[model samples]
Target: MRRTRITAAIAAITVATAALTACGGGTATGNGGNKNPKTLTYWASNQGKNLDDDKQKLTPELQKFEKQTGIHVKLEVVGWPDLLNRILTAASSGQGPDVLNIGNTWSASLQATGALLPFDDGNLGAIGGKQRFVASALGSTGAAGKDPAAVPLYSLAYGLYYNKKLFKDAGIANPPATWSELIADGKKLTGGGKYGLAIEGANNAENIHHAYIFAKQHGGDFFDASGNPTFTSPGAVAGVKQFVDFMASDKITAAGDAEYAQNQSLEDFAKGKAGMLLWQAAGVQLAQRGMKADDWGIAPVPVQSGAPGQGTQVDTMVAGINLAVFKNTQNRDGALKFVKFMTSDEEQKILNGKYGSIPPVTSAQSDPQFSNPEQTVLRQGLAKSAVALPQVAKESQFEDVVGPALKDLFADAAAGRPVTEDSVRKRLEKAQQQMAG
Candidate 1:
């Protein structure tokens, strides 16, 4: 089982949103009060440095919205997992915010909540909608391909970070260009209480991502033609094998590798206890704090040992925050106006730059902050080479099912009794059926 790694850096955004207080009304910035005092309640997920610390960019925008519209705005930031519960709790009681940020993958799930506004042509036009965002983001946010249910906020993707010094010391002149080389280098770097690769073996979502990239290398798809789960294919089996084998193989993973989580793996690599790992672009900054850039370098995930296509898992750390006038909020126009301001190109520029995120809008990619070499490559991958996780309503259940299964597989493999390809395929096939049913 491959663990799908969720970046916890976003936790602050989701956690701070639990606080929502006061609401008031305001006039349109230009026009006279279209209505009485308009109060807009805006909820956002956590952003960088500190949730409160990052408010300089947003509070000003809120004030601007208020001064122009004559509406007072209440701002609340929340963590990831709690965001949905808070929204549901508020919505059920008719006290939800006028706007709320949701995970991009949660777009479909939240849309099922029936509490969000659909970005129809008229509304989309108001905010420089879909056209401004990347196509993948647009695809992820839309339901039935008509229009997006949420506005794109920021974007993220995974990249390979390696210990440059380790590779040089291993008598390797160049980084791996193929998956076989990656494995070979991993083997060479093993021993001395260190690891060659730092995959999150115990994290199932991370496993799925690892499988997805490997399967794609063999021209395999996660869902069959009809969008049904088909995770038992030859390619998928092979992918899973590679993951289990890597952990089980001597010198590849640490003795406690299966027990390690995402943070553990990152710490190991940052401390030079590991050779390489797949991480979001943010890891570059984390590496700088503990290790020098010269000590670590990044590259795209390598191609399959001798397989096909550019198979890399481009992980995205984006969530679409949909703004809707609660059926009970009495301030529909004011709410819509506020959303328009936040998604506008000008504001998006500031958000993407200072927040260390990418705007869904494709145009935002051109911003200098995103123009850095690493960011530029990540943005490109999101469009041309990324594979999205299965965004089914049962996504959480899917994660639960795969997590322990992969842990068991990793343990078995590490003990030199890993599950065979044939057995893994059969087991995953049954799991897919359960998920489908």
Candidate 2:
């Protein structure tokens, strides 16, 4: 899930989330998925470079599960573009996998549908207990003060990744620590065919993520305590404007980046075509792309003022994948067993290690294998400054509406159109209107 902020643009989730109705036949419970308890259908998120890659990595693990439990897991690696839509469909249609992976941010929205098996005290106890999961990770698993709708699997937080060699070549000693510094340093690094920063301008999720953090940096909150949309608040308007200015005014980000939806910005950073990127847990991805670990440095995402911390200095969002079971699965026991197997310390290490994510399971997180510089910074962020996106039931609706709104603003900037606060507020106001409608 890469925190749900670092992946595909979840277009049209408005439709899927709107369609949810507890479960099949408008009831909170209905039978679906594999009929046999000895077998389970699984829809894993596309965490690897591609669907095939995820299949290759997970097959052996699935096989091991089968060998140990005699329950065969039939797997389908679903890509980001369609993962949410698919799950929502299953939740409403009474036809889906018994076990699936969801973006942890979706826990509340899906929980509202009552299609997921709630990890209450008893259910969580059956899956090795709730205390094993990280507290921050657990914070995003549904709304506040309720049993988690899903269990945390892979945990992540955003950070700024910079090319050390590029920095040295540009006579820069350290990464920028503030927004102004980032923009100024970026300007210096923007000559000749290299840009100072790479951005996913057109990706809806990416756009909303940056906006959310920028808003937090300026005392902005996307929703009121009652979960009403406040998208056009002064903090939000400034936040959206400041993020887009990297392209519109700062010129450190390439205009062509407005067309980027795939990991082109990431590719640019990894290939040294760009000097920097704001990302989540990218260590394994960079290494896989042949960039040496020593070639780069990781730091907290730049903030508006002082060091990253609570309130205005908040930087990253709590990100990662969660394991969920469909409420109406016929193979309930096997599904819970599989969840147990996946969250167990052994598999937590293996799966999160391969995916370059921090394990949400506390015992697994302490593994020395996860003690590298990147993981260290991310763990700190998670512990100190990272915030989860609003944990409201309509949170997915927020992403669906606001994310595209930000994408449009980026497009305007890329097209050399005016991107004033008025325009930003108007765009967000329309989004709020959509939410109200």
Candidate 3:
């Protein structure tokens, strides 16, 4: 569900130091006792269909806030590829937005930099308190028992999307509920040169996310409670093997799929060339590409039935964006006020409805628009089984190192090489070593 396009810029210790310097070496605490602030700068993530679309959707909200609070906001919509770099640069230079949008997974990484304000109990009360947010969504903002550096603004989750026509043609009566059934159904659906599954093997971020979910379902986690990597654990090995098996052992996916990115995989599924795809709420995009509403069906991701430590089904990462206030802001009160307004019930409904995402506020989830049939399955998955990525300082490293390692494994499997448990463990172990160093 991450919309990231991998960039070469690495977030290192030096980068964190620069960000801290930019923020004046102190925790952000309400404009240093100045209660009234005039204007605030806001950096928003690009979530609309186009770059300008986000601006259009947010401009009205900004105007509304200005009218209500008498505080004007200077808005800038940043693209994903440049957003991280911009934030880092601003953090180092002490010159950035007063408030900003960040990927939920980046909360821990950015919080470690000491350049963002922590939304502790006292600060959180200003925005209608901690009770306002969905508990699961709020859980992703920081590590266990810590005050979050950000707050949930939007929510998303993964779902198993299948081509209904293809399923009927294959005589499959239902979507899979277990890994074994999924593999078997895939085999039956694969024929006439089309694949049974579409995989974003080349996209490292997408690959790592799937790896995380699969590993968790198998009773393994990428990082232990203390943030040390466990990538080579038995559960992790089993989970990664299952992903690789889609192309290797099960043969439900094509060799070229090893080169497929997220968009390409979605394209293949929409074109009816792949029977199934694991993706977020992508029905809007699918419809734009000529796939009718009735052409596809959505289900929860399958789980490993008998894997050790497997409790309830673990389906997806609590995927979405969060809003954060920068420590460097001179107008902390103004920034905090603006943030509260953005997450209010009216704003959440309008923005989330336009962006095709779920609102992060618990009260907003009850809206009838969110309960539409097209989004029902994904909503159910989020409420029932979705888990967020480990809220660790090394979260980005997990994506950077382990992601590429898994990509290499997928490449090897696509080349018809024998992918053993030993092979998977070796790659994961190498990633663990890199993270430790």
Highest lDDT: give the candidate number.
2
List per-candidate RMSD values in Å. Answer: 7.4, 4.2, 4.5
Which segments of candidate 2 are over 4 A away from where they belong?
1-33
Candidate 3 segments whose C-alpha is farther than 4 A from its true place: 1-39, 48-53, 66-75, 306-312
Better of 1 and 2 by TM-score: 2
How far is 327's C-alpha from truth in model 3 (Å)? 0.8
**Candidate 2 residue-wise lDDT, 1-437, digit = tens:** 22233112222333343344233323333336356678898899988777898999899999999999999999999987788777766765667888899998888888877778889988999999989999999998999988889999899899999999989999888899999889988988898989999999878778877899999998998998998889988899899999999998889998888888867888899998889999988888788788998999999998987899989999999998999997777878999999999999999999999988999999998899899889999999999999999998878878778888888888998999999999999999998887766
Q: Which parts of model 1 are misplaced by more than 4 Å?
A: 1-43, 46-77, 81-96, 255-257, 260-262, 283-289, 305-331, 391-397, 411-417
Candidate 2, clashing residue pairs? Answer: 3-319, 3-320
Give the distance in Å from residue 222's predicted Cα in candidate 1 to where it truly belongs: 3.2
As a whole number from 0 to 100, the lDDT of residue 24 in candidate 3 is 55
> Scored by CA lDDT, what does every candidate get?
0.62, 0.85, 0.81
Count of residue pairs whose backbone atoms collide, per candidate? 46, 2, 4
Best by TM-score: 2
lDDT of 3 by residue, 1-437 (tens): 12132221334434654555554543433222222387777889977645787898899989999999999887889976567768766665555778899989878877777677899988899888999998888988987778998999988888889999999999999989788888999999888988899998887768888998988887888887788888898999998988988998899998899987547888899999999999877776687678998999887788877322224368788888999997756677788898899899988998888776889898988899998765687777777788889898778768877878888988998998988999999999998887765
From the highest lDDT down, the ranking of the candidates is 2, 3, 1
What TM-score would candidate 2 get against the native? 0.93
lDDT value for model 1 = 0.62
TM of each candidate vs. truth = 0.76, 0.93, 0.87
